[model samples]
Target: MELKTIEELNQIGFEKIGEWKINKRGALDYEITTDKTTEVLYSFVKVDNQKEEIIYIGKTIRTIINRLNGYKKPGNSQFTNIRINKEILNLLKSDLNVNIYLFKCNDVITYKSHNINLAAGLEDTLIKYFKPKYNLHGNQRIIDDVELSENLIKLTNDMNDDKNCQNHYLIEKTTTVSNLEGKINLGNVPFSFLPEYGEIINIYLGDIVLQANFINGNNNGGNNPRINCVAIGNWLRENGINVNDNFYIKICNNNSFYFSINKIY
Candidate 1:
């Protein structure tokens, strides 16, 4: 059987008394076909952030539409068999592409009572086939939306390796930097672990990214030289982070003494 679209399902009536679906929204928005309604409910179905993976699959027996609609809300956390985080739900409704592929049968099966068995089989078949992330019975391949670069992963692993890093100290703190006249006062940071001047570092302000250069200054007042990088200061301003916005810094590993700066919020 082929999965038919909403328009196609309307044109070609179902011959079997089993389940039918009209694609509504998200990755897989399906419902037990009924006499009324065109098709689809965003609930009882969800797609991952990238819309490349189907995250959840569900079935409703009586009052299928109501059951499907219940998934839209986070009630007493009792409606859904699997946990659906608020963030995940928001992503599903926002970015997930909805489509329905009706697997209509040849033989006609009309009434809802008879369609129960058929719906069960169809739901099970889809759950097993897709192995949706939210499914508890089928292929429980749960994967989140966190994306990590290979180099970042390796750097973190290296930081945690005792053999490579002996008595390594990790500092994760929120700090605000000073940018005055294209000069950045890095403050009382452990600059001993940092590389020489002219090297590059990364700075992220929300979605905006920037590459910053480290230029040495004269330490005439018994303090370490401040970094004079105009590009980063300008980039921060461009990204709506002025000279004193709180930025979160994460050092994947001091093995390279490289730290990545991220915008808070």
Candidate 2:
């Protein structure tokens, strides 16, 4: 399938049904009143002045209102809804602008002897072609990169085998709210990955270094050790490192570590 831009989708049949934004009470609200029962292929787009980019694309047989409500107050079992909700909230918190667009497909076509719902069929095509970041399919490539963590573990072991080696590495996936807030759980990392608790360490994000205190989670009843570096969180957000992206840390010594990001494409 070929990639289609929002403009191309608009030319094909998509419509600007309305916009969506967090309301005063922190709930998602669409600007124009819409039919609660209309099934649709909807998209979330980020707008910056005249520039627009599609971030997510989805189709639902469920009522449009019901679909949006799924994002507003996602159920525990609704993983997609939950992820999208967190992403949208994060974007809004950063003071970025987002809008929603919709398309209703009425045309039915037969494949072989079976009729296909155009919206349903088009959903996969759009996702595969456009690759909206918030959609699961859009993140498949980055998710596959998690294999890099396994390889990195092996490398760290190789380095640790050397009696004189003090350097180690940790490859972690950014999957928690704490990660975005400048705290990283070191529970899964080896004890040697960081210095002794209460010691100060320099965290390097490129050339920028932030000295931070270390708290060994083990000493605190097995609580995960953390690096509370607000600057790293701000850097991640500013650099568009959303949740689920993989990042690596190079522990150069007992007193310092550096970061490298594998951003989502």
Candidate 3:
């Protein structure tokens, strides 16, 4: 069935549930409700003779249900509506149970730009932590290992070219770089550095080493760089890196490193 509004979703009921942070004002706001009004829930559908499987999970506050309804429009929605994708639709339709949950709030909330970012981050973190099958985007595994080795080598070679360069050493097992091969088609390298040291660095396809830089560090004074990390993660996921793997990172005064694949989501 097609979901139109928050009320409709509530009326249909749900089988599983989750929570979301909503901004009551223009700042970061939290709604604590014992009534499950603050959470988004899910339901499942059984395909063929298989058991029920969750298809969607979401929440709404105020009249924003109109936005959900608008998803029916072609090419305008962020998610591919099952109605339009016959393959996915059939898969869900054949499911025995479809789980869905709704979070409703009486008061309207206004979100600031930064607060939106925070909410997004919170949502992403929760989805990643939960590993919900319906949350496909959250299941991405960051490409580390080989990519990290390659970037470290490239960086080492680059720095080595400088005659005045001092000793450069990467923190053992702390350096991690994402491999980007298929996603990007054109321009330059896309790389993202996590400032907390040892976080996986995402490098995009077609990105060069010159574009990579630390997110919140000194950058050691050099030209800014950008690399594709999403592509790397996609490649790794396709190749066998599990999304739930335990990522370890290490950083030294001059270098960084990452090690091991612990899990896949």
- Lowest lDDT sum, 10 consecutive residues, model 3, at 185-194
Model 1 lDDT, residue 225, Cα = 30
Give residue 217's error in model 2 in angstroms.
46
Q: Residues 1-265, candidate 3, lDDT per residue (tens digit)?
A: 5444344434544323322222334221122223423223222222335443334432222122222222222221112332323333344444332322433333333354221222222333334444446543445631111123334223333222224223222211112333223221111211211111112232322223322322211122212222334434554455465434433222221222222233211
Query: Clashes in model 1: which pairs?
Result: 3-101, 3-102, 4-101, 4-102, 15-107, 15-108, 16-109, 17-109, 26-98
Report how far off residue 142 is in candidate 3 (Å): 11
lDDT of 1 by residue, 1-265 (tens): 4432233333443222222232454422333455332211122333345334445544332243444433343233122321444434455456554332333333434464432234333444555565666554356421111111212111222232335433223444333455523454544556433322323343333334334444334222112334444554565556565544543443322212222245322
Better of 1 and 3 by lDDT: 1
Question: Which candidate, 2 or 3, has the higher TM-score?
Answer: 2
Give the residue spans of candidate 1 off by over 4 A: 1-52, 77-82, 85-88, 92-116, 140-265
The most accurate candidate by lDDT is: 2
Candidate models: Cα lDDT each: 0.37, 0.61, 0.30
Score candidate 3 by TM-score against the native.
0.27
Summed over model 3, clashes come to 52
Error of 1 at 16 (Å): 19
lDDT of 2: 0.61
